[model samples]
Target: MDYTAQILKNPIFKIVGEAADEMQVETYVIGGFVRDILLKRPSKDIDFVCVGSGIALAKTVASRLGNARVNVFKNFGTAMISYKDWELEFVGARRESYRKESRKPIVEDGTLEDDQNRRDFTINALAIGLSKHNFGKLIDSFDGLKDLKRKTLRTPLDPDVTFSDDPLRMMRAIRFATQLHFDIEPDTFDGIVKNADRIKIVSKERIADELNKIILADKPSYGFKLLFHSGLLKLIFPEMVDLHGVDIIDGKGHKDNFYHTLQVLDNTADRSKYLWLRWAAILHDIAKPATKRFDKKAGWTFHGHEDKGARMVPKIFRKLKLPLNDKMDYVQKLVRLHLRPIALVKENITDTAIRRLLFEAGDDIEDLMKLCKADVTSKNDVKVKKYLSNFKKVEKKMREVEEKDRVRNFQPPITGDEIIEAFNLRPGRVIGEIKEEIKEAILEGKIRNDKQEAWNYMLEVAQKKGVELN
Candidate 1:
């Protein structure tokens, strides 16, 4: 199919073609840009593959565009140019063969067909001609177009050879299936299962990248289910796999925490797109297995699972090579406080309790409520309704407390400096004690969250402590 009209709509393609013609090398738009255009997905990055030096073509195109700047990677034989909002990458059409120990491939200049054969998936092997003779022709040597139409993910070559050479493709396969909502062709999926162990050779960062893409997809659980069944989850993340299974004692059993976590993940996805919050949902009950116990009276109990799960978050993040920054902290805090709202729902919803929760959750109170609401996964309609109604009451109480006390992320009206100056004392336990008391008083509604009330309370505490005023 000729995409001349489509190519003409964007003047950048014509400029690229003109540059390729001047360089006297065959060039084409290939990989994701071509695939996404056919799928009608919005894509900002475009890749060009040329028969000769792609770096030279990039320089030529950049020079022609005048204002565009080209960044060349000498080691990788590739170049990049950012024009307006679009990032264009240029690479030589080359074939690759990988060593057994590494996913890195040995590259050599080759024909377009050779380049296409090296692609990880057939759908990605589709290319659009950019030469003068065939300015917009579609090239599909591996029936990639047919597979694209059928929404199937298959390798351009033997699945075993493809996966063995580069194990990261295994993760990519699952990621694509999740993101595109496409089916992995049976053989390709079988290849992933057969070579699941090979994924250990892949770097944690790359695996994390693919996992993040899967999590960011509209239906993340689908990808995770595939990972679990295909044996990849066990190899990459055994902690999660440990959450599977139901143990029965005297015909009493607990729900499968693995599937339960997935349900929570999906529920969270339906309400919010924040990746870390979804991560918090996945890990909210991660320590249930560790904390699980059974009694004849209670059947089963996962006591302190929330606290244990919160402690496990940092270790898991370190293992996964995820950022050890505030994102990880957010997940940890959510995991630690996940059951707090439910506790409030179960018992009396009081202003004091609401103020404490608001102070702890701070600006993330809304997100925490979202997670707590999603945590309700009961199949019983009446039970679910009752829990939801109770949650609404908890939410109402939270809002009232927040508006009245302004305690969400609230700082004590009395500072340590003020306490030190007033008591004429050095920085010590006394100052911290005073601050804590003031914060506690505000949260407990004993004193208003105002400077005057806090100063008066501080004076009373100081007098009781027998500290001399300055």
Candidate 2:
């Protein structure tokens, strides 16, 4: 198939073809750019493969494009140049062989066919000719166009050979399926399950990169479900897999926290696209297995799972090599407070409770509420409706309380320093007690969240503590 018209339209392609001809080397646009164009997906990055030195081709192209700087990686035999918003990378076509213990390949320069054969998936093996002789002809030996038409992810070569050579491709296959909403060909999927254990050879950073792509997809639950079925989730994230089973006792069985968590994640995805919030949903019930207890009255209870789950976030993030900063903290905070909104819905929903929750949740109050709302996934539609209605009411109350109290990210009206200065006392337990009392008084509406009311409360507490105020 000739797509010469498309390639010729781009000014950079003309320069690439002219440069390749001058150098007497063959060049073609290969891999993702070609596949994405055929699939009608927008891609700004293009890959160019040459039978000769890719670095030399990149330099020549860069020179022809008015001395555009070429960034070369000699070790990988690849080079890149940035033109406007597009990134073009050039690499020498090569064949690869991998050992049993490692995913790193022994690379050697070869023909274009060798490079296409080394591609992880058929859809990514398509190449568009960039030579003047047959510019725009698509060379697709693996029937990648057919796979694209079928909306399937299939390996170009033998499934086991392809995946075992570089186990990270297994994760990429699933990730691409989730991103494009494409199906993994049956044999390829089976190969993934069989070689799931090989994923350990890949680095955590690379694994996390693929996992993040999956998490950011439209329906993240779909990717996670695929991971679970392929046995990859158990190895990569045992904590999530731990929430899988349900134990029965006395003819009463609790809902599978695993599936329930996925439902919440999907619900969160529907409402918002914040990656950390989605992570909070995935982890909100993560400690259910550890906290699972059976009582005579409460057949099965996961007491303090939220708290335990919250504590587990840092460790999990560390293990996965995810960011250990505020993003991790955000997930942790949401997990700890996910149950608080539900508790308020069941109880009297007092101003004091709402104020505390608002203060603790701070800027994430809205996200926390969204998560709590998504948590209402009962088979009973009426119960779900009731919970949703109550949540709306709670949300209204929260806004009112937030406006009245100004308690979100609220700082104490009376700082500990003020208490110490007012009471003529040093920094000690007595000052902390007074500050706590003042803060409690403000939150409980015993006094207004104002300086005068807080000062008076401070005096009262000091007086009760037998401390004289200046």
Candidate 3:
């Protein structure tokens, strides 16, 4: 099909065409940009594959664009240029062969068809010609347009060869399916399962990157489910795989934490787009397997799982090469406190409890609430309704307490220096004790969170401790 009208609209295409003609080489805009255009997904980055030296084509294109700076990667036969908020990447068309032990391909310059054949999926193999003779004519040797119409993902070449060459493609396959809400072809899906172990040859950072993309999808559970079925999760993230399965004793059983976790993840994804929050959902009950217990009275108890799960977050992040900074800490805090708000909703909702929660969660209070709401995954409709109603009440109370107490990220009105002055004491344990008492009194509603009340309370505490102020 001719997309010449569409291609001509972008001035860069003309520049690229002229550059290719000048260099006496054929070039085409290929891969993701073409795939997204067919799927009606907006994309800004374009990939250009040239039958000759891609670096040369890039240099010519850059010079034609008034010497726009081009970043060249000689080792990869690739170059990139940024123009008009669009990133255009150029690569030489190449064929690849892989060894059994590794996923790295032996690359050699080839024709445009060879490059298309090397693509991971049919949809991604679509290309738009940039030659003056066939400007904007689509090159689809693998019927990528048909796959786009059917909402299916299939490798451009044989599935085994495709996945074996680069095991990361398995992850990419699942990610694409999740992002587009499409189905993997049955043969391709089976191929992923057979080649699941090949993923271990890939780097953890690359695996985590793909996992993050899958988590960001509209219904992320789809990707996780595929990963689980394909055995990739067991290889890459066994802790998550450990969450699978249900056990029974004396005809008593508990819900599968794995499925429940996925439900929570999907629920969170629907409500919020924050990556860390979705991670919190994924890890909210991660320690259930480790902490699982069964008693005659209680069929199953994952008591303290939240705390254990929180402790597990950092190790998991380090292993996956995820950021070990505040992002990890944020996910850890959410995992630890995930059950607190829900417990309050179930019990007597108190202002003091709300104040403490608000104070602890601080700026993340809203996200924590969103996570708690998403955690409501009862199969019983009536129970779900009851839980939601109670949550609404708890939320309303939290708001009221937050407004009155202003305790979120709140600091004690009485400072350590103020305590030392009021109690006629030096910087010692006595001053710290007084400060703690005053802060607790305010949080517990025994005294107003104001300087006057705190000062009076401080004096009372000192007097009780037999420390008279001069």
Q: What digit string (tens of lDDT, one per residue) describes model 3 on residues 24-87?
A: 8999999998877666688899999999999989999899888999999998989999988899
Q: Which regions of candidate 2 deviate over 4 angstroms?
A: 1-4, 423-426
Give all TM-scores, in the order shown. Answer: 0.98, 0.95, 0.94
Alpha carbon lDDT of residue 394, candidate 1?
90
Provide the global lDDT of candidate 3 against the true structure.
0.90
Off by over 4 Å in 1: 2-8
Better of 1 and 2 by TM-score: 1
Q: For each predicted model, how many residue pairs clash, with residues at least 3 apart or on different chains?
A: 0, 0, 0
Please report how far candidate 3 places residue 259 from its true position, in Å: 0.8
lDDT of 1 by residue, 1-470 (tens): 44435644688888999989998999999999888877888888999999999999999999999958889999999999999999999999998988999999999999999999999999999888788987888889899989989999999999999999999999999999999999999999999999999998999999999999999889899999999999999998999999999999999999999999999999999999999999999999999999999999999999999999999999999999999999999999999999999999856567888899999999888899899989999999999899889989898888888888899979888888888888789889988888898899998999999999999998988888888789
Backbone clashes (count) for model 2: 0
lDDT of each: 0.92, 0.90, 0.90
Clashes of 1: 0
Candidate number of the best lDDT: 1
The clash number for model 3 is: 0
Ranking 1 against 2 by lDDT, winner:
1
RMSD of each: 1.3, 1.8, 2.0
